[model samples]
Target: MSTNFCETATRVLDIEAKAITGLKTYINQDFNDACQLFFNTRGRVIVSGMGKSGHIGNKIAATLASTGTPAFFVHPGEASHGDLGMITQSDVVLALSNSGETEEILKLLPVLKRLGIAIIAMTGNPDSTLAKLADIHLCARVEQEACPLGLAPTASTTAALALGDAIAVALLEARGFSADDFALSHPGGSLGRRLLLRISDVMHDGSQIPLVDEQATISAALLEISRKGLGMTGVLNAQGQLAGIFTDGDLRRILDQRIDIHQTLIVSVMTRNCVTIRAEMLAAEALKIMEQKKINALMVVNAEKVPVGALNMHDLLRAGVL
Candidate 1:
């Protein structure tokens, strides 16, 4: 009577995987019609479902909304109450019900039709009432459920979820959705921080910037770097333009040569023609440059190469772009 749990789990995964693969054949003209319906709609894509289908519907709606096809979910039961008001004639309906005969969902069909809202149906039974009533039926039919007793919504729900993801991705491509657009929809997440943040938003600027005159001694640059805590100092010429840069790494290199930090001028040892970035450039771009060039810090400048700000790996880490 001992149950082999691992064996059962593996079998369940295989069954679910096969069920999702079966959805490939169903992606025919009906799939295209569904995508077109979602893409052409000026208003939101309203998704509704019952039971387990409702959970999948919520995720599907979220995916569509984040991927540039504005959508939201309304429980079929709630839609029968007052949530139906959330949907308008301009919006399209995506209804999910594996059996295609859910009473709650079927109840809304007449009202949605009277309003002239197109319905895209996802169900296991293509011949069921919901499928027949829908303007476009996306058959999510599967050979069997992964449940040992052949009752629970296992493989069937997995197949439905995969099909929903496929439609969302197809619509995303058709809508020309980009990563930046996705970031805008997810501003509170790390991806948003990485994509939307600019160098100016995080860099040390004004008096926070470590700066020294080109004629300043190495000791002066070290003091500026220490006081500013940026590990580097921008050396400016008499014309008030960036002449070079001196860093702690430069100090280490010059230290071995026994160059007197108090007497040696910064211009002689500072790195000239150094890498610089614009304040307007994305902070992610700055991270790319730092990784590619094997550097820890960057100077943010303007069109004239005047040092406007400075940032390091620490700044990016704090901003969650790392």
Candidate 2:
């Protein structure tokens, strides 16, 4: 029984895969026209459909909205009651129906026409009324349903969804949508935290910064590093500018050379002109610099190159950037 079940599942996957592959033939002038219309629209793309098609439409609208194209899904059954008012003349309608003759969707056509809203229809039947009425018609035709009984909308819906993704991606590329732009739409996600989190947001600032004068002895710098627990400290010159940095690694080297911590000036033993990042730079950018420099800590500097803040890898890990 298990073997039979596995075979059935594999058959379903094969049929759906073929259905998605067959959609490539329909990526012609009609698809291009549909994308052009969607891209040029100043208002939102209003997506509508019935039943399973409605579910697919909702996801497509979300993908479009998140990827630089503004869109929303309005159920056709609800649109016939009162939701039709949500669509405006400036908005473009993207209607989905496998047979291209869904009654609830058909009921909205006259009202949509009177409003002068452009319609783009995605259907398996090109000769159907919905396709005939649309300004652009995309053929999502598939040979057969993945369902063994040929009763459920399986392969057809998968084809329609893939086609929707293709359109969304094409529009995303045409608009030059970037990862930072995507992060703005999803600020609550991990990618947003990585891209939008500035060094100022995560770095130790003001009194929390581990800093010592360049003229201070290595013992004083070590005391600051111990107090701050950042495993490092910044050595500033008499002019209040960043002169050098002293880290745990630097301490290891100094100890190897038997330099007396009480007698050596920090400027004489510290790393001169260490790598620094801007306060406004992203924390992810800081992580890249730390990895490249083979260091665990960095000093955040201002436009004038004065050390303003400090952070270590632990801060990044705690902030969910790592």
Candidate 3:
């Protein structure tokens, strides 16, 4: 790598660190008040900025939206050209600018004020017009830019991004937002699959479930396991209650005892205290139980302790819960 490239990277890191440290003082009541305003707003948060600030604003909007807060990004330049219609009195505007004096953002302030929209200004200069005009001001000031020329927005942008995150997280906690709620917003993602997928959704039911009577011979149980392809069979008593479980591991133990599979009753050789999970339980929760017990499969039982379904590690793997 070039020496100049390494030097530039170091400068970037230094400025970003300074920017984060400078944000300590900015985390006071004003930040909380700003969060309250967004949380209470009936309409969406309209984040607006220009250039790099705009990019950061987009991400902040998305984070807020995915975390149970309604939000969307708007371009200040576009707002001036009639997109201001997107802003309403019930909505809150979060304006981002390093100097707090971007002309394009300033142009929309009048319309925003006329509509009675609340403004939360994120700026490096608290004394700037945007700061003075806003209902709440979040100071994203930095000691210096990372740029060698001292004109770029490196430090200031980092401060703004961190402040945005702080607001989103605070609101998330205040609203009692949870991982399950986040998964709802990201249903197509891996997190959603883990939290939303249930054992009933991945478990084998009906004829696919490996089952055998307690009176069944070990050979018969083995045939059921082979036919069901789960490497295990649920042993049910004559009263249709869960008696025990016969798995490949149980067979290994039985063989070690020199038991004859063709003659031994499945219940006599099966594993007692078999681990079982309910069909209504989340697949992720079931996976944790399986892992903690160091097992690979679980029989899904109903309220009466009857085996209604079955699942194994392969089921979790195929469902993306692994």
Candidate 4:
């Protein structure tokens, strides 16, 4: 590592930290009005800027869209060519510029005004022309740039990014958004599978469920376990209700006692008060319960206490719920 590398890294950290801390002064009525404008807008939020500000605007637009607000990015350079048509009077535009004077963005202001679209300006200078002309102004001023040359966008851009996140989270809370709603927007990811996957979708049903009558011998239960390949079997009484469950652990206990597998009835030796879950429950919830109870297997029962399905640790593992 070079000596200058460590000093540059420290300067970057100090400047960014100060920028975030300085945001407290800017988080006032103007910020609230920006959120309100986005909340009430009938059309999508069209974010635009130039250079580094444009990059920040793109990220802000993405965060808003994923967090329940409808928004997308538009390049200011493109807006002059033909993309300005994308903005409508019903929509709200959020424009970013650290100097409040990016030429490319200034070129579109007259057209935006002509369309009667509301504009929110995010800039460091409140007195600049862009801020004066906007419906709302969000201050993203940083005390200094992190670059030793003090010319790069480093600290100011970081402040803008954090402000964008703050706005998204505030809207999310105001709308009472939940994890399931978030998963819906991110359906292609693992989070969606964890939140939406159900026990019935992962549990073994029908012939895969090991079952035996109360009168069945331990030898018969063992055969059912082997045939079903679940390392366990549900013991049912004459009424067809679940009586107990006999698992591989029980087999070990019986073997130590020298119980005759041929003569012992499963009902007499099977485990009572077994843990179970319903087929309709979330697979993630079942995983939590299994961990809390220190057990690896569970029976799926219906309202009638009839064994409808079964699952073990391996099932959850294969389902990616582990």
TM-score of each: 0.84, 0.82, 0.86, 0.82
Clashing pairs in 4: none
Clashing pairs in 2: none
Worst 10 residues of 3 by lDDT: 1-10
User: What is every candidate's alpha-carbon RMSD to the true fold?
Assistant: 3.0, 3.3, 2.9, 3.4
Model 1 alpha-carbon miss at residue 98, Å? 1.8
Deviation in Å, model 3, residue 44 alpha carbon: 1.3
Clash number for each model: 0, 0, 0, 0
Please report how far candidate 3 places residue 42 from its true position, in Å: 1.5
lDDT of 2 by residue, 148-180 (tens): 789899999999999999999999999999878
Under the 3 Å rule for N, CA and C atoms, how many clashes does model 2 have? 0
lDDT of 1: 0.92
Residue 221 in model 4: shift from native, Å? 4.8
**Where in model 3 is the C-alpha error above 4 Å?**
1-18, 144-151, 189-192, 253-255
Off by over 4 Å in 4: 4-11, 212-223, 231-275, 291-294, 320-322
TM-score: model 2 vs. ground truth: 0.82
Higher-lDDT candidate among 1 and 3?
Answer: 1
Question: Model 1 — TM-score against the truth?
Answer: 0.84
Question: Residue by residue across 1-322, what tens digits does model 3's lDDT show?
Answer: 4478887798799879988987998889998899989989999999999999999999999999998899999999988988988888889999998888899999999888888999999999999999999999999988888886888777778888888898899899999998788878988877889989988999999889899999999999999999999989999988887888988887777777888889888888888888899998899989999899998899999999999999999999999998
What does candidate 4's lDDT look like per residue over 111-161, in tens digits?
A: 989989999999988999899999899999988988778898999999999
Candidate that beats the other on lDDT, 1 or 4, i.e. the better one: 1
